[model samples]
Target: MEAAPTPTLLLAPMEGLLDFVLRDVLTRVGGVDRCVCEFIRVTGSLLPDKVFYRFIPELRNGSRTLAGVPVRAQLLGSDPSSMADNAARLAELGAEGIDLNFGCPARTVNRHGGGAAMLREPERIAAVVAAVRRAVPAHLPVSAKMRLGYDDPGSAMQCALAMQDGGACEVVVHARTKADGYRPPAYWERIAPLRQALRVPVVANGEIWNLQDAQRCRALSGGDALMLGRGMVADPGLALAIRAADAGGQGEEAPVEVRWQALAPQLARFWHLVCKDLDPPQRAGRLKQWLNLLRRRHPQAQAAFDQVRVMTDQRAITLWLQQLVAAAATADGQAPADPAA
Candidate 1:
């Protein structure tokens, strides 16, 4: 009997939020197949190699995170020539793949005729994808991330077909229009027809927060692959939990879900990375930002957030994290971890 293929789980590129640091922590925790780096906004001139390295330090580590998951460098721009040029440079820099950004809803991006603004022009979308495809090596996959449409889903199919016509190997559709904007009740159902219409694989994104949501998303989107963003951020073990649930349903033992105790080490690891890599002024806020999101899934995170919410001193925050890690490790019956490490 033939075994089913493993579902492809991709960590989404969230500009300003899910950079290489968080990507490293999440991928290390396990079960993500690939990650797309935050979009590198390419304009008229060719960007320096340092720019790519800055956004995706993994590029220096063979375009993979420290955990060794392949990272695809994403490019966002309106000019096909410039996008193609920059993508060629990314390929030369040994990028595993190149992903286009057509889904960013930022007004600044839209005003510049980048991101979701391209959804309004299917022809332009096709051109940008085609140009980038032509520039990069054929073996290197070129993909795109897009919203359903600019304001509504009326042009969704046309835009998707444009991407296909332009030779994108895969397309990830965030199931909402630009107007919808990160609200509850993601229109997972809208992805079904796009999946049906596209020849290449269509991965569904948006609002998948847990196992039940993953199941419902698969059922509604009619696709096995998923791209996770904020949902995965809120719960670091979401991908593993989904995979375990899937395996358990197929008569395998389901491992215990990752609890806050297990997550303490990862949080400590995150703080270590933040302190080591980021600037001093940014360190405290970065920790607080993650705790703010983490509080959504774990009550322990709420306590942690409360403890650090008023703190701006890096040394003070570090001390708090060290204590937190030690307490969590003790609760789990293990030796305390070096939070500074």
Candidate 2:
């Protein structure tokens, strides 16, 4: 019998989060096929090569993550000419693919006529994609990430078809309009219509909190690929679990102690990498953001996060982490307490 193809699962790139360290850690957990870099805003002249390297350091090695997973560079902009120019530069820098961000709902992005706001103008979306396709290398894949619409689901189908006509290889819909903004119960049903409307591959995104959610999303969109976001932060092994369940393998739940023990090193690694480029205070804030998500999986994550948050002094934060690690070791075999609770 011919083997079924391995489903493609992508890790959605989050700005000011999901840096190289986090990507490295999550990719190790398995089942993630591709990773997209945070959107690099292209406003004016073509970005210098260093800018591309800074946002997508993976491009240094032909856009491959540390684990050999391919990473695509994502761009956010309103100008088709500038976007196409930048896409060409990214391709020259060895980027394997280019992803356009039309899904972000941030007011700043929307006000700039970018992100979800672009959905209101299907012609502009098509023009941007067409221009970029013309400029970039033919073999380099160009994809787009979009929300359902600005304020209504009705607009998405037309926008999606426009993106397809404009030459996008695939479109990833976040399953909600701009107004939804990370709320509960994502309308996966809405994505179904958009999928049927477009000839390009559709990858579903949003509110996929577990294996069941993933299955439901696949059924809804008739899509084989999925893009995971915040859910991935709460449970790093979610993709692995989903893959296991799909393969008829039983899922193993890691004990709280094991979860924390595994996370501590990852936290430290992320901190170390950020500190190398960012100042101490900025690095600390980034650490807190990660801990905020880590706390969801292992409640005990707060003890370390709180220590880092309260202490303004960098040296003190480092000392507190050392003590927390020591304390965690001594509390072996006990049910992990929820520090955030």
Candidate 3:
């Protein structure tokens, strides 16, 4: 039998969690093929270019992560014209690609008629995507991501068709609907119809937290590609593991222990970036957010988070993280099972 093609692995765009700093860290870790910028809110008159830069500063750097992985700028809104206008401006600013977010389920965004809330109006999704597709250069890839639906899980097919009608080259379907709201039972099976129905590539999302989940998702969703969000955040090595599996090996080929060892410096870099952009309190909070997520996958991260969660100052938090890392690194450079491991 002919060998199966390699699956495309994308880093899902996360709002507050996966900012430029985390994007840099994850992309630099390697294996993630592409990333989407945190959803940029387009409200009222065309947002100044600076706004896109603030959310996706990599635009100024050729829309690439530090490791040169491409980063697409994602816009969120209900206005077709404004979204189209903003997409045009981003393209002008050297954005590598454009991703429209129809999958965000945050109450704040939904209240404003953006994100997953737009999924409820399939026609509007088509119109907005069509407008943006017209605005961007034909050569530049345009894509959109949405959950199954607003309240009904059955709306996925309609939403996928809307994206195709609007000229989207690819569509990612998060297995659940807006009503699901990050709940358990991600509905991976629901992506099958979207994959079968859409002429374009259908990328699966939601509930892929590990290698086992990735296998199940592909089988259930009938998709050759995946966009991982919290899965990537909680376990930074997730993309590498998934890539390993896609290549016909168990994802465990890359030892998670060594992955954590290499990841320590990246956390330090994240702290530095947070300190530079945010005040002291925000800095600690940002680090804490990552730590909390990492804790779900690594005990070392849990210990680190416990040590600094109450600390209010950036410098002190930096000192704590650095010392912990220093102690973790050994003569042979293998990660220890505790803080360093």
- Model 2 poorest ten-residue lDDT run: 332-341
Sliding window of 10 residues with minimal summed lDDT for model 3: 332-341
Candidate that beats the other on TM-score, 1 or 3, i.e. the better one: 1
RMSD of each: 1.9, 4.4, 3.2
**Candidates by lDDT, descending order:** 1, 3, 2
Per-residue lDDT over 1-341 for candidate 1, one digit per residue giving the tens place of the 0 to 100 score: 99888999999988778999999999988889999999999887799999999999998999999999999999999999999999999999999999999999999999999999999999999999999999999999999999999998989999999999999999999999998888888888999999999999999999998777888999999988999999889888888877887666542222344688877878888888998899998888888888899887888899889889999987887777778878888888899866444
Candidate 1 vs candidate 2: the TM-score winner is 1
Candidate with the larger lDDT of 1 and 2:
1
Each model's lDDT comes to 0.90, 0.81, 0.85
lDDT of 3 by residue, 90-138 (tens): 9999998889999988999999899999988899999999999999999
**Residue runs of model 3 more than 4 Å from their true location after superposition:** 1-4, 253-258, 334-341
Candidate 1 lDDT trough over 10 residues, lowest sum? 248-257
**Each model's number of backbone clashes?**
0, 0, 1
Q: TM-scores for all candidates? A: 0.96, 0.89, 0.93
| Model 1 TM-score on a 0 to 1 scale | 0.96
Cα lDDT over the full model 3: 0.85
What's the distance in Å from true for residue 85, model 3?
Answer: 0.8
